[model samples]
Each structure stands twice: as structure tokens, then as C-alpha cells.
Target: MDIEIFPYRVLGSDTTEALLNDLESLEDVKRTVIHGPRFPKGEATLPPKYRERRVININGEDVVLQVKTARIFLEITMESTIDEIEEICKEHIPYGFDINQDRSNYIRKQQTVTDRIKYGDKELPDELVGMTDQYSTFDDHVKIIKKDD
Candidate 1:
């Protein structure tokens, strides 16, 4: 089942990076995506600290964080793995977070008309199926991490 992790406060770049690194390390975790409000594009007049994009290191890879972390959607097979995830969140997310399991469709389950039009006759991997909304692009919202082979 898919689980949604809602943090009490909006997470910054550093916290998001740390939390995602730990969550991606879990064996039971199949896929994970962070969803949140996008930072404004025009920040020229603002100070550097208020800059929208931040480069965060994940598993030694640098990823540009474009939004503040609002909710994390995780796809997992084992229910017990939620405990481990909670432990990780507790360590990094001092503000607190709630894990919701009641929702049946946290992630999309079927392909839409856009998907059909985007890649006609081509098949999309299961991991890429429901990662983004119809209006948004994958790179704008979805971040895919695979375990080492």
C-alpha cells in the first residue's frame, strides 16, 4: 500500500535531503516522491537566503530542490517498514510528521489521456506511472531513486 508522510511544518532543503536519503535506504521502499509548493521563479530582488532552488546531496548525487517539502508519498510492500521510516523521520524531522494509511489512492493507479498522448504506443515503467500530476512534468516534481544492484 501507499503511505503519505505529512510533516507538521514545511521542510527546508537540508531536512528534505537528509530525510529522503534515509527513506530511500530502506529495502522495503519501492518508490518515493516528494510533493510540495513550488518556490517563485522571480527572486532577483530578494536576498540569496530566500533563493528558491537549493542543491542537495542525495546518496552522493547532487539534486536541485525546487520546492519546500509538504508531503512525501511512499510506495512500500511491507507494512512493518513504516516503523523504520517513522524512526528515521523522528531523528531528522524534529518538528513532527504524521503517517496516513487510510487513503486508498495517494498515488495514481491508472494511465490518463495525457499519458496516452505523451507517449503514444510506448509503455511507461511502473515507477513513472503516477509520479506527477497531469499538468506537471516529471522533473518538476518526481525524484526516482533506485537501490544499488
Candidate 2:
């Protein structure tokens, strides 16, 4: 149901952006979550090449990348999708990576009290659930990227 991709080293913004773009394009990928320490405030003080790219273009939408990619959790439908994901990773994460089908709750798959209180009776789309940062308001975190129909 879910697979975790761990790179040998934390990935930079360009690699993360390329990997995410490829993964999001796959039909079997339902959702993807990036887990790691976020770029600290005043990160711009670092050299341009070492700086965390705050924004990246994915499927034509600009998204702010909050974290340095330590791990990537993906919800996939078919087993074959794992191999496809590996291929995409090979191209982007050239440093090598490991994929595990761990049954851990990497991402919240169900709605919570916060969801009902925040959304009221209107059904929240499956794609939108668990995409927000608990530390920040929904509007501050999620940049709704409209995928092609």
C-alpha cells in the first residue's frame, strides 16, 4: 500500500524537485510525502549552490519545498509502480537509494477531529488530507497544485 524511499544522503532541492515531478506524473502514485528537517530560517545566508530552493515547479504548479529530503513516502496502487519509482529515482538520486514496504504510519491516511472542525460538513478530498503542516495554518502550508484532469 505504501513504500518509503530513503536516499543515501539527504537530497538537495534540485534532486528533490526532479524526483517529485517524476513520481507525481505516475498514474499509480496516489500521494507523496517528504519527511525531514526543514530549511532553517536565514538559510539564504548559505552559498547559492548550497541554498535550499524555497520554490519548485511540479506539474506546472509552483510549490514551496519545506524540507531537505530525508525520506519520501508514496501511496501506490500496483506492485509494478515500485520498479517504476526506482527507475525515476535512479535518474535523479544518482547517489543510490533504498525502498522499503514498511507498514509504518508515515503519513496520516484517515481524517481527524481537526479535519471535521476545520472543514465542517463538506467532504475533504482524499488528495488534500494530511498535506498540511500541523505547526502552521493550512493556508500557510499547502499550496494547492492543480493536476491535469
Candidate 3:
């Protein structure tokens, strides 16, 4: 099951960071993909505090956010988790947000023609099937955060 968190306005780095931390804490929220316009690469046009690509701590790992956080796609374990996710969004997205449950598949589970072109015949792991845009290299976009004992 999957749910899409669509905020009325683009979310900043701090909101994205806090929202991700909260959502990821839920066991039912299996996987997440944050989608938005890519931040421009170069000297910071905005002040340091307003920068969009700032590094954020998810769990314990610090990962740099590359997108402006227009929409957040969460893959959950069951349909019941939708309400729980809604509550979380209610608290985080004050400007207004929608919990879209209608989308049958927010996260892609199958490989496409683009995937074939990017990866050839080499098999890809299930978790990485649609985590990235075909135009971008996998390493540049995908960051798998694993905890250490």
C-alpha cells in the first residue's frame, strides 16, 4: 500500500527533515521517495539558513536533500496506516496537505524501458526499481541509510 502526501506549498528543508524523521519512525512506512524540483547547483543564492539542499539527519545518518519537497510518497505495509500518516501530516504541514490514497502505485515496483536503457540486462534489486528518474544516475539520487550496531 502507498500514500501520497501533497502539501499546498513547497516545503522547506527543516519541514522536510522533521517530516521525514517522523514518517520514517513508523514501521508501516516501508519506503519513502521525496519528489520536487531539483535545487539549482552553484553558490547559494539564498542565505545559509534558507538553502534548500542543506544536509538533514534521518535516523542517525546525515543526508543532503536535493529536492524542494513538493510531494512525499510513502510505501506502507497496510491500508490502515493511512490514517496514522494523515495525522502526522496534519501536525507537520500546517499550510495544508492532502493524504491521497487513490494512487494505486506511488512507488514504481516494475522496471520500464528507461530502466532497461540505464541498466541493460543486469538485474536490479526490488527496492531500487523505481526510486530514481531514468535521466539521472542511480548513485547521484539514491541514498540507502542503514543503521550500525
Pick the lDDT winner: 3
The reply for model 1, stretches above 4 Å from the true place, is 132-141
TM-scores for every predicted model = 0.88, 0.86, 0.90
Which residue runs does candidate 2 get wrong by more than 4 Å? 117-122
lDDT of 3 at 47: 82
Pairs with steric clashes in candidate 3: none
Report the Cα lDDT for candidate 1. Answer: 0.82
The per-model lDDT (C-alpha) reads: 0.82, 0.84, 0.85
Question: Which ten contiguous residues of candidate 2 have the minimum total lDDT?
Answer: 132-141
As for lDDT, the candidate ahead, 2 or 3, is 3
- Candidate 1, residues 1-149: lDDT per residue as tens digits? 89999999999887898899999888898878788888776855689886657788777777888778999998898899999999999999898889999987688778777777655658888877765466766676666656786
**Best-to-worst lDDT order:** 3, 2, 1
* Candidate 3 similarity to native, TM-score: 0.90
> Which is the leading candidate under TM-score?
3
Give the lDDT of residue 34 in candidate 2. 84
TM-score of candidate 1 relative to the true fold: 0.88
Cα RMSD for predicted model 2:
2.1
Clashes of each: 0, 0, 0
List clashing residue pairs in candidate 1. Answer: none
Candidate order by TM-score, highest to lowest? 3, 1, 2
